[model samples]
Target: MMDGASQFATTMLLRPWWLLALLALALLSYLALRRVRGLGAWEQAFDPALLAAMERFGHVVPGAARRIFWPVAVAAIAILALSGPARRIADPDTFRNLDGIVLAIDLSRSIAEGGSLDDAQAAAQMILQLSAGRPVAMIVYAGEAYVASAFTLDALALSPVLAVLDGEIVPNAGSRSDRALDLAATLFSEAGILSGDVVLVTDGDHLTPQAFDAAAQLAAANIRVNGFLVEPTARHGDMPAPDRDGLERLTRLGDGSLGNAADPAPLADTIGKRAASALAKGETAALFFRDYGRYLLVLALFPALALFRRAT
Candidate 1:
């Protein structure tokens, strides 16, 4: 049953959108242009020739002497990138070339019902595909969670672990994601898993307050959490997992909670993109585009007039 607490529609995340910081960066870039010895030197060397040439263009006749900023601007922007443009994209995607990752799957009773099996199958496929030869550790939790598969990027070797998931596995343990997440965190903390990534797949149903607490704790660690929700409808063999109130709270905490009403297909695809993007952006684009996109443009519009006459 949906509880009033879960119904409270407050946004859960803290977003520090850097609008002001970006404006400042743009302002600074413009100032840097003012001090550029290269542009000034180039202007001193070619300004006379450029001005004389612009005077020939009928249109330049009106302001021929004043239009000498275009080529210098292009050169400046390219120079900026050469100096450090890739650094600006700030947050770009990254390849998982470093270490093996963990894929913790939910195998509680609910996973077998309500079209959840299909979702489970799809999630498994995505994990294996995305793992890309990185070692993956699998865990299944219903009421109780256990390591079904150890860390191995080889998905083929992990099949035994994934296939063991079923509703009957948990018995009377009761649904508790906290335990599952706790296990994952602990697993990753092991010396071997300390440096790799972590992927968690589950239906955000039957979450207890403890789950959210556990999720909050796990997030504080360096592990990356990605959720794949399996469907909850009755058909397809899903059973009575707990109600929704607590699960909603858990979702708010994990942020990694990815989903579509128990459908893993979309969750897998979306989380894959987000994880890949977040990783890449952090390494390359995040620092740049997150704040410098507009600042870089200031130099462009201000000095573009110089090159326009020449190109024409």
Candidate 2:
């Protein structure tokens, strides 16, 4: 139910039609004054010589000036106060990114050797820093997949989860880029984001038929996959060599570029650009209204107070 005060406020008008009330009063007052003057009684009651003497000394009463100014001024103030005034407040939805980011890290036995996972982690941290607090999700996958954290803007909160990730976190053995990418895609789908990028941090040592199919699916879904191929200088001759050609193809198919872990600047720049574009597109076209009518009412008080002052 609407309160009495709210109902009354809405009914009031700054430019009220009842302002004609003042006009009617002024007309009536003018007619009455004219009739009184026509009767020649009020003027007769005052001596013509006394009125002329008063005018000569500049001590004439300012009744005519007061009538001409105060009523109109007070009415204008009251009318304006009745007109509602408002301020603008920014809407939260307008500033939020419509898309989301999913970081898919390859946490296989291969990344466990020669500090490859460490380098990937460092690169991932840089990517997060560059994001400027866009919503981000994390996926660590070997033969099996595990979600370290869901999409969120709070990097500090996600840090603890990211820190605890290791090759052993996924019980299964071997690198499965296909499973990781698919899971990242699933995360984006579940979150209801139609378009976003998935960053793959790996050595690119293996690529099953499933990986190629997953990349195609991701591309069709408008999900770009970026790759960071981390190949450390210290050679472990026993370990299998990374497939550079396969990594390049993965990036090409994913509609993104493959960057070397040693120089992540180019990849970071690209990711940063995409994030900026998303943010710009997310802003609301319309502004929100905030009521400032009460403050306007305070303004009416000044003119209202002037009503009591003698008109100049």
Query: What is residue 120's positional error in candidate 2, in angstroms?
Result: 0.8
217, model 1: CA deviation in Å?
Answer: 2.1
Model 1, span 1-312: residue lDDT tens: 355454333212112343344455556556555645234454566677785676577433332322334554555554443333322222222333334456666666666655566667567766676554455677777778787766664667776656666677656555567778788777776734323445556666666667677777765654545555556556443356534444445545655555543455565554444343343324433422334334566667656654545544
All models: lDDT?
A: 0.55, 0.70
| Residue 69 shift from truth in candidate 1, angstroms | 24
Candidate 1, superposed: residue stretches over 4 Å from native: 1-101, 113-115, 132-134, 168-172, 191-200, 233-248, 274-312
The weakest ten consecutive residues by lDDT in model 2 span 279-288
User: For residues 166-229, could you state the per-residue lDDT of candidate 2 as single tens digits?
Assistant: 7678899888899888899889888877567888888887788888788888988877888999
- The top-ranked prediction according to TM-score is 2
The whole-model C-alpha lDDT of candidate 1 against the native structure comes to 0.55
101: Cα error in model 1, Å = 4.5
TM-score of each: 0.51, 0.58
Tell me each candidate's RMSD, in Å, in order: 14.5, 14.1
